[model samples]
Target: MLNKVYFSALLFLSLTLNAQTSPCKAAHIGKFQVDSGESGITVIERNKKTQTEINEKMGYKARYDIVWIDDCHYELRNRTVIKGKSWEGSSPTDILKAEILKVVNGKVFLRLGSNFSDEVMECEMIKIKS
Candidate 1:
Protein backbone atom coordinates (compact mmCIF):
# COMPACT_ATOMS: atom_id res chain seq x y z
CA MET A 1 0.00 0.00 0.00
CA LEU A 2 2.43 2.68 1.21
CA ASN A 3 5.27 1.03 -0.70
CA LYS A 4 3.36 1.13 -3.96
CA VAL A 5 2.59 4.81 -3.55
CA TYR A 6 6.27 5.58 -2.84
CA PHE A 7 7.37 3.68 -5.93
CA SER A 8 4.82 5.51 -8.07
CA ALA A 9 6.00 8.88 -6.78
CA LEU A 10 9.60 8.04 -7.60
CA LEU A 11 8.68 6.91 -11.08
CA PHE A 12 6.70 10.07 -11.73
CA LEU A 13 9.61 12.22 -10.56
CA SER A 14 12.04 10.43 -12.87
CA LEU A 15 9.76 10.82 -15.83
CA THR A 16 9.27 14.52 -15.16
CA LEU A 17 13.00 15.11 -14.96
CA ASN A 18 13.63 13.22 -18.16
CA ALA A 19 11.04 15.23 -20.04
CA GLN A 20 12.58 18.52 -18.96
CA THR A 21 16.06 17.81 -20.20
CA SER A 22 17.09 19.87 -23.25
CA PRO A 23 19.61 18.00 -25.32
CA CYS A 24 21.69 19.30 -28.19
CA LYS A 25 21.01 17.61 -31.46
CA ALA A 26 22.31 17.58 -35.03
CA ALA A 27 19.48 19.85 -36.05
CA HIS A 28 21.26 22.69 -34.29
CA ILE A 29 24.07 22.61 -36.84
CA GLY A 30 23.16 25.44 -39.17
CA LYS A 31 23.07 29.16 -39.79
CA PHE A 32 20.96 31.20 -37.43
CA GLN A 33 20.02 34.84 -37.19
CA VAL A 34 19.05 36.91 -34.21
CA ASP A 35 17.58 40.36 -34.37
CA SER A 36 18.92 42.11 -31.34
CA GLY A 37 16.68 45.00 -30.35
CA GLU A 38 19.48 47.52 -30.04
CA SER A 39 22.61 45.92 -31.46
CA GLY A 40 21.21 45.12 -34.87
CA ILE A 41 21.11 41.75 -36.57
CA THR A 42 23.52 39.05 -35.53
CA VAL A 43 24.26 35.97 -37.53
CA ILE A 44 25.77 32.77 -36.28
CA GLU A 45 27.04 29.89 -38.32
CA ARG A 46 27.84 26.68 -36.50
CA ASN A 47 29.49 23.48 -37.55
CA LYS A 48 28.96 20.72 -35.06
CA LYS A 49 31.47 18.31 -36.57
CA THR A 50 34.29 20.86 -36.50
CA GLN A 51 33.13 22.48 -33.32
CA THR A 52 33.62 25.88 -34.86
CA GLU A 53 31.40 28.93 -34.96
CA ILE A 54 31.44 32.13 -36.96
CA ASN A 55 29.56 35.12 -35.68
CA GLU A 56 28.80 38.37 -37.40
CA LYS A 57 27.39 41.17 -35.36
CA MET A 58 27.11 44.86 -36.13
CA GLY A 59 29.64 44.54 -38.98
CA TYR A 60 32.31 42.81 -36.86
CA LYS A 61 33.16 39.22 -37.64
CA ALA A 62 34.46 36.83 -35.04
CA ARG A 63 35.20 33.15 -34.83
CA TYR A 64 35.19 30.74 -31.96
CA ASP A 65 36.14 27.23 -31.04
CA ILE A 66 33.35 25.50 -29.23
CA VAL A 67 33.70 22.95 -26.50
CA TRP A 68 30.57 21.09 -25.58
CA ILE A 69 30.12 20.50 -21.85
CA ASP A 70 27.00 18.50 -22.46
CA ASP A 71 24.31 18.03 -25.04
CA CYS A 72 22.72 21.32 -24.07
CA HIS A 73 25.67 23.51 -23.05
CA TYR A 74 28.90 24.67 -24.68
CA GLU A 75 31.76 27.10 -24.19
CA LEU A 76 33.03 29.37 -26.96
CA ARG A 77 36.60 30.65 -27.00
CA ASN A 78 37.46 33.39 -29.46
CA ARG A 79 39.59 32.34 -32.43
CA THR A 80 39.19 35.49 -34.51
CA VAL A 81 42.55 37.12 -33.96
CA ILE A 82 44.45 34.25 -35.54
CA LYS A 83 43.09 35.02 -38.96
CA GLY A 84 45.14 38.20 -39.56
CA LYS A 85 44.32 40.79 -36.95
CA SER A 86 47.38 41.83 -34.97
CA TRP A 87 47.07 41.68 -31.23
CA GLU A 88 47.62 44.97 -29.52
CA GLY A 89 47.84 45.25 -25.75
CA SER A 90 47.01 42.41 -23.46
CA SER A 91 43.39 41.98 -24.34
CA PRO A 92 41.62 39.32 -22.37
CA THR A 93 40.50 36.38 -24.44
CA ASP A 94 36.76 36.60 -24.92
CA ILE A 95 34.87 33.50 -23.96
CA LEU A 96 31.20 32.76 -23.54
CA LYS A 97 29.21 29.84 -22.29
CA ALA A 98 25.84 29.12 -23.76
CA GLU A 99 22.97 26.76 -23.25
CA ILE A 100 20.11 25.79 -25.48
CA LEU A 101 17.14 26.64 -23.35
CA LYS A 102 14.52 25.50 -25.81
CA VAL A 103 13.86 24.63 -29.43
CA VAL A 104 10.42 25.05 -30.87
CA ASN A 105 9.20 25.39 -34.44
CA GLY A 106 12.68 25.89 -35.93
CA LYS A 107 13.63 28.54 -33.42
CA VAL A 108 16.05 28.10 -30.54
CA PHE A 109 16.10 29.95 -27.27
CA LEU A 110 19.62 30.51 -26.01
CA ARG A 111 21.03 31.63 -22.72
CA LEU A 112 24.51 33.13 -22.93
CA GLY A 113 27.07 33.88 -20.25
CA SER A 114 30.05 36.15 -20.71
CA ASN A 115 33.41 35.78 -19.05
CA PHE A 116 33.32 39.20 -17.43
CA SER A 117 30.04 38.81 -15.57
CA ASP A 118 27.66 36.37 -14.03
CA GLU A 119 24.72 37.90 -15.86
CA VAL A 120 22.95 35.83 -18.44
CA MET A 121 21.25 37.01 -21.64
CA GLU A 122 18.46 35.21 -23.36
CA CYS A 123 17.93 35.40 -27.10
CA GLU A 124 15.91 33.64 -29.69
CA MET A 125 17.60 32.47 -32.88
CA ILE A 126 15.89 31.42 -36.06
CA LYS A 127 17.43 28.85 -38.34
CA ILE A 128 18.23 30.43 -41.69
CA LYS A 129 20.01 27.52 -43.24
CA SER A 130 20.76 23.95 -42.42
Candidate 2:
Protein backbone atom coordinates (compact mmCIF):
# COMPACT_ATOMS: atom_id res chain seq x y z
CA MET A 1 0.00 0.00 0.00
CA LEU A 2 2.80 2.41 0.87
CA ASN A 3 4.54 1.70 -2.39
CA LYS A 4 1.36 2.34 -4.36
CA VAL A 5 0.76 5.65 -2.62
CA TYR A 6 4.39 6.74 -3.13
CA PHE A 7 4.24 5.90 -6.83
CA SER A 8 1.01 7.78 -7.28
CA ALA A 9 2.38 10.87 -5.55
CA LEU A 10 5.56 10.78 -7.60
CA LEU A 11 3.60 10.42 -10.84
CA PHE A 12 1.38 13.38 -10.01
CA LEU A 13 4.34 15.57 -9.09
CA SER A 14 6.19 14.67 -12.28
CA LEU A 15 3.21 15.44 -14.45
CA THR A 16 2.64 18.77 -12.74
CA LEU A 17 6.24 19.83 -13.22
CA ASN A 18 6.22 18.83 -16.89
CA ALA A 19 2.99 20.63 -17.56
CA GLN A 20 4.30 23.82 -16.01
CA THR A 21 7.66 23.81 -17.74
CA SER A 22 6.84 22.17 -21.03
CA PRO A 23 9.47 22.42 -23.76
CA CYS A 24 6.53 22.41 -26.17
CA LYS A 25 6.01 26.05 -25.14
CA ALA A 26 7.79 26.95 -28.35
CA ALA A 27 4.74 25.72 -30.21
CA HIS A 28 2.79 28.69 -28.91
CA ILE A 29 5.08 31.39 -30.33
CA GLY A 30 5.86 30.41 -33.91
CA LYS A 31 4.35 29.26 -37.22
CA PHE A 32 2.55 25.94 -37.37
CA GLN A 33 0.53 23.68 -39.65
CA VAL A 34 -2.82 22.30 -38.57
CA ASP A 35 -5.02 19.73 -40.28
CA SER A 36 -8.59 20.89 -40.59
CA GLY A 37 -10.26 17.87 -42.15
CA GLU A 38 -11.69 19.02 -45.53
CA SER A 39 -9.27 21.90 -45.45
CA GLY A 40 -6.49 19.31 -45.11
CA ILE A 41 -3.70 21.49 -43.68
CA THR A 42 -3.06 25.18 -43.18
CA VAL A 43 -0.17 27.35 -42.12
CA ILE A 44 -0.59 29.77 -39.27
CA GLU A 45 2.04 32.29 -38.31
CA ARG A 46 2.60 34.80 -35.64
CA ASN A 47 0.65 38.08 -35.85
CA LYS A 48 0.15 38.35 -39.64
CA LYS A 49 -1.28 35.20 -41.24
CA THR A 50 -2.76 34.23 -44.59
CA GLN A 51 -5.43 31.56 -44.45
CA THR A 52 -5.48 30.74 -48.17
CA GLU A 53 -2.49 28.42 -47.77
CA ILE A 54 -4.68 25.59 -46.51
CA ASN A 55 -4.00 23.12 -49.32
CA GLU A 56 -4.37 23.15 -53.09
CA LYS A 57 -5.30 19.48 -53.15
CA MET A 58 -8.10 19.99 -50.67
CA GLY A 59 -9.47 22.95 -52.63
CA TYR A 60 -10.47 24.67 -49.45
CA LYS A 61 -9.52 28.15 -48.30
CA ALA A 62 -9.34 29.16 -44.64
CA ARG A 63 -10.30 32.56 -43.27
CA TYR A 64 -9.34 33.60 -39.80
CA ASP A 65 -7.42 36.09 -37.67
CA ILE A 66 -5.81 35.41 -34.33
CA VAL A 67 -5.76 38.60 -32.34
CA TRP A 68 -3.91 38.39 -29.07
CA ILE A 69 -6.26 39.95 -26.60
CA ASP A 70 -3.44 39.44 -24.14
CA ASP A 71 -0.52 37.05 -23.68
CA CYS A 72 -2.72 34.07 -22.75
CA HIS A 73 -6.07 34.87 -24.40
CA TYR A 74 -6.92 35.60 -28.02
CA GLU A 75 -9.80 36.87 -30.10
CA LEU A 76 -10.37 35.93 -33.74
CA ARG A 77 -11.95 37.80 -36.57
CA ASN A 78 -15.05 36.36 -38.14
CA ARG A 79 -14.22 38.43 -41.16
CA THR A 80 -10.92 38.28 -43.08
CA VAL A 81 -9.41 41.48 -41.73
CA ILE A 82 -9.87 43.34 -38.52
CA LYS A 83 -12.12 46.34 -39.14
CA GLY A 84 -10.63 46.63 -42.64
CA LYS A 85 -7.25 47.23 -40.98
CA SER A 86 -4.67 44.90 -39.43
CA TRP A 87 -4.13 47.12 -36.42
CA GLU A 88 -5.01 45.70 -33.01
CA GLY A 89 -7.29 48.50 -31.84
CA SER A 90 -9.31 48.36 -35.05
CA SER A 91 -12.83 47.05 -34.65
CA PRO A 92 -12.71 43.32 -35.20
CA THR A 93 -15.57 40.87 -35.12
CA ASP A 94 -15.92 38.85 -31.94
CA ILE A 95 -17.82 35.98 -33.52
CA LEU A 96 -14.72 33.79 -33.45
CA LYS A 97 -13.17 34.71 -30.13
CA ALA A 98 -10.99 32.06 -28.48
CA GLU A 99 -8.94 31.70 -25.33
CA ILE A 100 -6.53 29.25 -23.66
CA LEU A 101 -3.48 30.28 -25.67
CA LYS A 102 -1.08 27.81 -24.11
CA VAL A 103 0.68 24.79 -25.61
CA VAL A 104 0.23 21.17 -24.55
CA ASN A 105 1.87 17.95 -25.69
CA GLY A 106 3.76 19.66 -28.55
CA LYS A 107 0.67 21.44 -29.85
CA VAL A 108 -1.22 24.66 -29.33
CA PHE A 109 -4.98 24.55 -29.67
CA LEU A 110 -7.61 27.23 -29.85
CA ARG A 111 -10.90 26.39 -28.29
CA LEU A 112 -13.67 27.58 -30.57
CA GLY A 113 -16.73 28.36 -28.55
CA SER A 114 -19.95 29.54 -30.24
CA ASN A 115 -18.04 31.37 -32.94
CA PHE A 116 -17.79 29.30 -36.10
CA SER A 117 -20.47 26.93 -34.83
CA ASP A 118 -22.68 26.23 -31.86
CA GLU A 119 -20.51 23.30 -30.82
CA VAL A 120 -17.11 23.65 -29.19
CA MET A 121 -14.22 22.87 -31.52
CA GLU A 122 -10.51 22.48 -30.87
CA CYS A 123 -8.00 23.38 -33.60
CA GLU A 124 -4.45 22.18 -32.96
CA MET A 125 -1.31 23.89 -34.22
CA ILE A 126 2.18 22.44 -34.53
CA LYS A 127 5.33 24.48 -33.97
CA ILE A 128 7.53 25.81 -36.76
CA LYS A 129 11.18 26.00 -35.81
CA SER A 130 11.96 29.01 -37.98
Candidate 3:
Protein backbone atom coordinates (compact mmCIF):
# COMPACT_ATOMS: atom_id res chain seq x y z
CA MET A 1 0.00 0.00 0.00
CA LEU A 2 1.05 3.67 -0.33
CA ASN A 3 1.34 3.86 3.49
CA LYS A 4 4.11 1.23 3.52
CA VAL A 5 6.03 3.03 0.77
CA TYR A 6 5.82 6.34 2.64
CA PHE A 7 7.08 4.80 5.89
CA SER A 8 10.08 3.24 4.17
CA ALA A 9 11.08 6.56 2.58
CA LEU A 10 10.89 8.35 5.93
CA LEU A 11 13.10 5.76 7.62
CA PHE A 12 15.75 6.06 4.91
CA LEU A 13 15.84 9.84 5.22
CA SER A 14 16.30 9.70 8.99
CA LEU A 15 19.21 7.25 8.78
CA THR A 16 20.98 9.22 6.08
CA LEU A 17 20.76 12.50 8.04
CA ASN A 18 22.06 10.92 11.24
CA ALA A 19 24.99 9.26 9.47
CA GLN A 20 26.62 12.56 8.55
CA THR A 21 29.22 13.64 11.14
CA SER A 22 30.71 17.13 11.51
CA PRO A 23 33.67 18.18 13.67
CA CYS A 24 32.11 21.55 14.49
CA LYS A 25 29.32 19.87 16.39
CA ALA A 26 29.02 20.36 20.17
CA ALA A 27 29.90 16.69 20.76
CA HIS A 28 33.11 17.41 18.81
CA ILE A 29 34.16 20.87 20.13
CA GLY A 30 34.18 22.11 23.73
CA LYS A 31 36.01 24.66 25.87
CA PHE A 32 39.04 23.04 27.50
CA GLN A 33 39.78 23.57 31.23
CA VAL A 34 43.45 22.80 31.90
CA ASP A 35 45.49 22.33 35.07
CA SER A 36 49.30 22.53 35.33
CA GLY A 37 51.28 20.18 37.53
CA GLU A 38 54.84 19.51 38.67
CA SER A 39 56.95 16.34 38.74
CA GLY A 40 58.17 14.18 41.66
CA ILE A 41 56.00 12.44 44.26
CA THR A 42 55.81 15.37 46.66
CA VAL A 43 54.83 17.85 43.98
CA ILE A 44 52.16 15.59 42.50
CA GLU A 45 49.83 15.90 45.46
CA ARG A 46 49.92 19.69 45.47
CA ASN A 47 49.09 19.79 41.79
CA LYS A 48 45.59 18.47 42.41
CA LYS A 49 44.55 21.54 44.37
CA THR A 50 43.60 24.57 42.28
CA GLN A 51 45.12 27.08 44.73
CA THR A 52 47.87 24.95 46.27
CA GLU A 53 49.62 24.08 42.99
CA ILE A 54 53.46 24.28 42.99
CA ASN A 55 54.24 24.67 39.30
CA GLU A 56 55.31 28.19 38.38
CA LYS A 57 56.31 27.49 34.79
CA MET A 58 52.68 26.85 33.90
CA GLY A 59 50.12 28.33 36.19
CA TYR A 60 46.67 27.04 37.11
CA LYS A 61 43.59 26.49 34.96
CA ALA A 62 42.46 28.73 32.11
CA ARG A 63 39.83 28.71 29.43
CA TYR A 64 41.27 27.30 26.20
CA ASP A 65 40.02 27.92 22.71
CA ILE A 66 39.53 24.72 20.74
CA VAL A 67 39.24 24.05 17.02
CA TRP A 68 38.84 20.75 15.22
CA ILE A 69 41.36 20.64 12.36
CA ASP A 70 40.14 17.20 11.31
CA ASP A 71 38.95 13.87 12.70
CA CYS A 72 42.38 13.22 14.17
CA HIS A 73 43.88 16.75 14.27
CA TYR A 74 43.05 19.41 16.90
CA GLU A 75 44.49 22.69 18.21
CA LEU A 76 44.59 24.76 21.42
CA ARG A 77 44.96 28.48 21.85
CA ASN A 78 47.18 30.52 24.20
CA ARG A 79 46.33 30.75 27.90
CA THR A 80 44.08 33.60 28.96
CA VAL A 81 43.63 35.02 32.45
CA ILE A 82 41.19 37.31 34.14
CA LYS A 83 41.66 41.09 34.49
CA GLY A 84 45.39 41.66 35.06
CA LYS A 85 46.46 42.64 38.55
CA SER A 86 47.03 46.37 38.86
CA TRP A 87 49.17 45.99 42.00
CA GLU A 88 52.68 47.34 42.07
CA GLY A 89 55.42 45.12 40.53
CA SER A 90 52.83 42.87 38.93
CA SER A 91 52.51 42.01 35.23
CA PRO A 92 49.03 42.56 33.80
CA THR A 93 48.91 39.66 31.34
CA ASP A 94 50.81 36.49 30.45
CA ILE A 95 50.96 35.58 26.78
CA LEU A 96 51.81 32.07 25.57
CA LYS A 97 52.01 30.32 22.20
CA ALA A 98 49.18 28.46 20.53
CA GLU A 99 50.13 24.93 21.54
CA ILE A 100 48.66 22.67 18.89
CA LEU A 101 48.06 19.32 20.60
CA LYS A 102 45.92 16.21 20.45
CA VAL A 103 42.24 16.00 21.43
CA VAL A 104 40.67 13.61 23.96
CA ASN A 105 37.24 13.62 25.61
CA GLY A 106 36.53 16.76 23.60
CA LYS A 107 39.50 18.47 25.20
CA VAL A 108 43.15 19.22 24.33
CA PHE A 109 45.70 17.22 26.36
CA LEU A 110 49.40 18.18 26.64
CA ARG A 111 52.31 16.17 27.98
CA LEU A 112 55.31 18.06 29.35
CA GLY A 113 58.92 17.19 28.58
CA SER A 114 61.48 15.62 30.94
CA ASN A 115 62.97 19.00 31.85
CA PHE A 116 62.39 22.18 29.84
CA SER A 117 61.04 20.30 26.86
CA ASP A 118 57.40 20.03 25.80
CA GLU A 119 57.91 16.28 25.78
CA VAL A 120 57.29 15.88 29.52
CA MET A 121 53.97 17.56 30.26
CA GLU A 122 51.64 14.67 31.07
CA CYS A 123 48.28 16.12 32.04
CA GLU A 124 44.70 15.68 30.92
CA MET A 125 42.39 18.60 30.07
CA ILE A 126 38.61 18.69 30.06
CA LYS A 127 36.04 20.93 28.46
CA ILE A 128 35.01 23.94 30.53
CA LYS A 129 31.55 25.34 30.67
CA SER A 130 31.53 28.80 29.13
In model 3, state the lDDT of residue 47.
18
lDDT for predicted candidate 3 compared with the true structure: 0.39
* Candidate order (TM-score): 1, 2, 3
* Residue runs of model 2 more than 4 Å from their true location after superposition: 1-29, 48-53, 60-65, 81-94, 114-116
lDDT of 2 by residue, 1-130 (tens): 9999999999999989867854433543556787777746766555443222244454444456556565556555654542223435433364555655567666776676744357777777776643
lDDT of 1 by residue, 39-129 (tens): 6776778886333333343345556777788888888775564233433542437667889887878888889997767889898888888
Q: Say which prediction, candidate 1 or candidate 3, comes out ahead on lDDT.
A: 1
**What's the true lDDT of residue 97 in model 1?**
80
Each candidate: what lDDT? Answer: 0.70, 0.57, 0.39
Error of 3 at 3 (Å): 24
Deviation (Å) of 50 in candidate 1: 5.9
Better of 1 and 2 by lDDT: 1
Give the deviation of candidate 1 from the true structure as CA RMSD.
Answer: 4.3
Score every model by TM-score. 0.66, 0.51, 0.28
Q: How close is candidate 1 to the true structure, as a TM-score?
A: 0.66
lDDT of 3 by residue, 13-95 (tens): 99998797643342243334445334322111111112111233434323334444554333433333433322254232422
